[model samples]
Target chain A: MGSLEYRCLKATGVYNVLSEALVEIRDVNFAYGHRPILKGMNLTFPKNKVIAIMGGSGCGKTTLLRLIGGSIKPTSGYVKIGGQIIHELDRAGLYAMRRKMGMLFQFGALFTDMSVYDNVAFQMREHTNLPEEIIHDLVMMKLHAVGLRGTHDLLPAELSGGMARRVALARTVALDPMLILYDEPFAGLDPISLTVVGNLIKRLNDALGATSIVVTHDVQESLKIVDYLYFVADGVIITEGTPDEIKASNKPFVQQFINGEMDGPVPFHYPGGDYQQDLKLKSIERVKNNKRKVTERYFGLDRRQKKK
Target chain B: MMAALTKNFVGLGRRVMNSLWRIGIGARFLSLILLNSGISFSRFHLTVKELFFSGVMSLIIILVAGMFVGMVLGLQGYETLKRYGSESALGSLVALSLVRELGPVLAALLFASRAGSAMTAEIGLMKATEQISAMEMMAINPIARVVAPRFWAGVFAVPLLAAMFSVMGVFGGYLVGVVLIGVDEGSFWSQMQSNVDFQHDVLNGVFKSCVFGVVVTAIALFEGYDAPPTAEGVSGATTRTVVESSLAILILDFILTALMI
Candidate 1:
């Protein structure tokens, strides 16, 4: 059975219309033990739309997702979902909050010991009191959604990278969560699998009427479906807009990232002194040092004279 | 000179602090295993399966080693007793030596090598691969689902295995002392029956082995859980399991033996 909101959205044909904030991250600062990651990030994810949080490697995109999920708390400020502050929740309370949230990890992260069916049925088995028959039906339905119904008996290792990811996607949305966070969902994917996963993420979000936040550096697939975009760099949201607006963004870092440019604000080369000049200086120093190193620099050895 | 002295002091402090921290965390993990045990009664199959893996898998080594050690003890005890005309008490020596010391200590050492290292590697690989993180995302505690069954398995398995080792050891000593070396079989059986008390010898050895099981299993799980999420991390955790578990078994053996005595 489809959700009433999803059915209504289908009837109205305005599926992407976002209404009200489901997640609010305010002045959130996070660090991993003395090394700062997110430096006061402020953003909102609206319900009933796909939002992309894109950044280069090590730019704290995944940290923002983890913060929202309450896996790790922020150093300062708050992450609120439906007006409840996340970090203030007790362990039981945090787990209760997390039940409503679903996340897809970078790799599939499926349990190696379990088969595909078990992986998909994990959330249902843990959280629900449904009978095995109902759970089986539900698991099948979820797997069917990702076109992996036949692969149910296969172990995670047996599946290819793409199939494992699809199983992960199916597992993520199994509970029909109110929110979904995807951490690099399109990473390490072939073009064919990429399109299938991209379409599935969008379709599932709209069908389930769930708010979706995807943290990815895969600009092409992200731009295809994400309704809103935020480009993070150096631990801050430097630019945010609709996909069209993001493409037209003139911000140097954003342009460098989204346009896939070789050099701009984020340099192609590492930050160091002039390479050619340093090499020449080193060569000259070596030449001068090499001149005095034969016999004079070593033992003042007149071993030849001693032998004579 | 001041900087060097200060650095030495800091290094010493850090070593002490790290050791204390490990002990504290390991205790907490043990408590968690106990708590999870209550909930896992419904998951009886999982616990039984782990018992088969960790406990039943260790039977071969325990049996073989126990037999060999008993044979060696019988050979040595007969030689030593020959000089003093005390060869009649060979049965008591074999039984007491095995039930008091060798059974628990050697079985535990074997368990640590075979099963404990494997547990650490399995859990560490799960961590490195983000399966733990995935379980957390699903609002499921991995410790409850993964570690608890294995923990209870080791706790129950080790003592049983130690007892089995002792029985086999005594049998092996009988094979050598009475049958091969032509000792008086009646006297050998009589002396062992009289001297080996159920409460003092067998039960203490059982208790010691149970404690060792907890310590070894706890160290293995903790190292894996606290391991950095990488290939090198899992490998390091496995190494730590072997080294730390072996050292813990020896040190704990000394303390337990001294205190129990």
Candidate 2:
């Protein structure tokens, strides 16, 4: 373990050397108005490991990150991070707790007005009393670590999508956060950039010795880097295991998800009436329409012909 | 018939409840801004940059619009006063109109359309792009860093812009009345000085503009921060900012004017 991890673990004083889970979600439920998103979710993220939460869109993966980050409160139950309940903290307490956390939004979410250097330096400047010289070196080191030191002067708009994501990654790790959350970090990336980002997440997690939770749909890349995998569907964890176990499992959902099948327990189409019945009705309507058209053509009573 | 009536009543109640809920949220947001406004002042540079965008950039429109309004008032006032053999009172008419009513109202309307809309669009876009969320996750209160500076900047900018508008208006009136129409320059100056009271006219107008500044900025910021995180949502919020600010300014002007009178 790194010295920073040791110090953090020591400071928290809640976890033993063995089985040190940094975050624990206990029967947490969340909803937007009447629409329930997450229901009775129980998960543990261990320290110094990379865990990937895999799910289709709108499966409450991002919502899970928000819950862990203390941005939103769960409706019932709680999320405990480093021994403190996230939603129970007051504003000041929450902000203090947030200082130990970092989130990489799906689209980088860099301040478009600020350059890459300023973006990386933002957390340090805001949270610490460090002078400009130290901040400059720290920002540059972060940029270099992301392999984008040359693009430090560029605005987010000036950088490519991949470079922008890299800068955002650098910014996320700038404070050496104890827990890092990534929301679809591999989305909308070329092959090379995807691999680069995937490797960077692993390397950064190891170097910082921080617990990282990656919420992603990129199954292949996630399987390659993640220590454990949790598959979420319809707001609950359906299954979870190591990559090899997931690959070898006979569960229909797991097999379908892994193989990218067109039809499975997750259904290819939205819920609707009987497909054949609907198609037959449409065919009958089309036949009637065609007969009407033929009659109109025979009588030279077509709307187009009349208009002309 | 009974069901239809019940449904209509329910719809009306829901609309009223929603409006009240929004107002409550806006009040809470304003308090958050006040609570977090320390950084806006302490850092100061952030506020200054916002002021440049919301204030300095608005100068040309405020000045030019003021001039045109003043000139129109000059011609119209002279034409009306000439019928009553009081054309020499044109200066007093123009000055009182500009300083008392036209300056604050017109400047605020323009600011609502120009600076206020821009403020909403910027914040809404930031929210849509998740910059605000990123800031929150970074342990930075976005109200302090983003909203407060712009809020305070708009609050400071509107009154200054109004004053500039009034001053330019006076100059435009002078040019039209004294130079173009050949009204006696001494009578014009004397009449304006005697008729335009410092406290009643100038101070009240400044106070009105200050009230307008608060109203416009608050509405714009609230709409932006409350906007849904989507492109269409941001665009809608921007439109609402202008519409709501303009309506609020006009209504507030009526109340303030009635109270002052």
- Top candidate when judged by DockQ against the true structure: 2
**Can you write out model 2's per-residue Cα lDDT over B74-166, one digit (the tens) per residue?**
888888999999989988999999999999999999999999999999999999999999999988999999999999999999999999998
Give the clashing pairs for model 1: none
Write one digit per residue (lDDT tens) for candidate 1, span B22-119. Answer: 88988888888888776456878888989999999889988999998899888998999889998889999999999999999888888988999889
Clashing pairs in 2: none
Q: Which stretches of candidate 2 lie over 4 Å from their true place?
A: A1-17, A276-308, B1-9
**Local error of candidate 1 at A251, Å?**
3.2
Best by lDDT: 2
Kindly list the per-residue Cα lDDT of model 1 for residues A43-74, writing each as its tens digit.
Answer: 87778789999989999999899889888899
Interface RMSD per candidate (angstroms): 0.7, 0.5
Q: Each candidate's DockQ score against the native complex?
A: 0.72, 0.84
| Candidate 1 chain B minimal-lDDT segment of 10 residues | B34-43
